[model samples]
Target: MPKNKMKSGTFIAMCVVTVLFIVMPLFLQVSVIRNAIAWILSGLRYQEYKSAYLGLVGGLLGSWLAITGAIYTQRKFDREKEEKRAIEEKRAKEIDKENIKEICREMLWSEIRQNDNSLSCDNGNFIKAIMEKNDCYFYNRDSHRITTDNWNFIIDKVISMDLELAIKLMHLYKYYEFMTDFDGSADSAFTKSQLDFSKYKECYQDVVEYLEFPWAND
Candidate 1:
């Protein structure tokens, strides 16, 4: 039999036995019981009365033991059931957390690749044209600040797990923001910002390489 069914069966049987021995006799008027009560009431010998009283005590004791055992079994079953349910709930939560992490990883990876491609092509052209002291208007017009939306979505998780990566991404994205907001018409500001672009590009490269070999960070 299953453990639950067996536990229930044993508990029920114990309850029935306890009721029959302890509760039923109080109301039951069988001839044997009636005669016993009469014998006691008639002032039977002290020795005989003492033996009968001892028997009653033994019967009550047995019933009490049966009740105690039944209660213990039921409690044990309940405790085990609660523990099993808790274990299952914890496992389910772990699975859900892992699923969220997986989704975040895929999304982050896509954003990284997209930004890396932009930096290598359009952004690279703009930086090169500026450094060469050539007309950079067309190159600058074709390039824009990189998107940081995807990184923002999972920034908290990334920072919690990898502080170094988080810092690198922050520096790179901040530089992109500066680039977008920089006054390109001011010669002095444009020269300073263009010079800093190399540093931002280095930070971006660091993040990409770190992500590529994530185990090294660990």
Candidate 2:
């Protein structure tokens, strides 16, 4: 069962308790309960039975008020805690999306860098162009910042909209993983096959473009 579904039983129990606390006080009017209360307070050191009875009723009223006040405060605390937790979860999700978006922006620029020398830092328009196309910001990097979580998420998203782009990313990730640690592999034993990465980089741009507005395809 879902966490929320199970918690509903607790919520229902609280409602019942609140209703009983409110309505039970009204039942003090019954003659039987009134007799019982008077009998209990009769032995107390008061000037007379009527005085002791009034003292007992006042004490019971005070106790009931305190109990209801405590329940109200506890419910309020629970509500505020749940609201704060929800807000925190939303903020975390937004931050992760931003990280991914920044990474995709960088990858898109890599493909365009060869053609437009202005793709360099001095030119700020490339970022705006990317935003105009898509809003999905997936995180991608060569080192600690790179994670399978976001990579897999983006792959699934792209596969749903563009299967070919997803496949391209799968292959590219193999090399991207290696580049992250070129310092250790600078003296590897054999010469690997050589190939132009231009086509592959261009595919990265396509991936970014598609992700920016995937819903448009719908």
Highest lDDT: give the candidate number.
1
Runs in model 1 lying further than 4 Å from the true structure: 1-45, 112-146, 150-218
Model 1 lDDT per residue over 146-186, tens place? 55677675666666555565677677766555444443432
Error of 1 at 134 (Å): 27
Clashing pairs in 1: none
- Lowest-sum lDDT 10-residue window in model 1: 136-145
Q: Compute the lDDT of residue 81 as modeled in candidate 1.
A: 95
lDDT of 1: 0.61
The clash number for model 2 is 6
Task: Name the top TM-score candidate.
Answer: 1
What candidate 2 gets wrong by more than 4 Å, as runs, is 1-54, 111-172, 175-218
TM-score for each prediction?
Answer: 0.39, 0.35
